[model samples]
Target: MILIANGNASRIGIHTSIGDFAATKDGKTYGPLNTDGAFYNMKMLMFDTKSRPIGILVMEIPATSATSEADAARQAEALRKEVSEKIPDLEWLFQHS
Candidate 1:
């Protein structure tokens, strides 16, 4: 699974190339998506609670994309709707398959 954190997640970590990477696409490793913003920091991470540990990723998302507050609000709402509709199903498939 994937976890997105905006400065709420920070701890000891590890990075290695021993297993699967989610950003790997079309036989090409695009690496991780580094989320960056203005008002706060963002991060993306993968972990298995039952297992000891494997890998970790950190992303910083910026709130600098919007030119104004209203624009930011609108964009945020749109992105929320778009992602909320698809991510859950995608996650279910990922877990089941």
Candidate 2:
């Protein structure tokens, strides 16, 4: 994703992979929640392996733009959906994360 920082003087494009695990209130699983300041703030309940959340995996991508937070959120969600649908081992990674 491309991010414009320092009032557009510094632009950063990042390619990131998933890193951590978290669960939603409803027992759904997702991960690597983008802690990047430009991304939407997503919160999830963290748990240990014994909890074994239901196997749906959602991934968060960092917000892709600096101008519009809403657009960046939409882009991130879309990328998450695309990755979840296209990447076959996403579940395994989610489990391990």
Best by TM-score: 1
The global Cα lDDT (0 to 1) of model 1 is: 0.36
Model 1 ranges with Cα > 4 A deviation: 1-37, 40-64, 88-94
Q: What lDDT would each prediction earn against the true structure?
A: 0.36, 0.39
8-84: candidate 2 lDDT, tens digit per residue: 34433332223323244454333332555545443233222443332332334355543354554455455545544
Q: Output the TM-score of candidate 1.
A: 0.31
Model 2 residue 46 distance off true place after TM-score fit, in angstroms:
14
Give lDDT tens digits, candidate 1, residues 17-39: 33435432233212222343353
Model 2: runs farther than 4 Å from truth? Answer: 1-64, 87-91, 94-97
- Per-candidate TM equals 0.31, 0.30
- TM-score, candidate 2, is 0.30
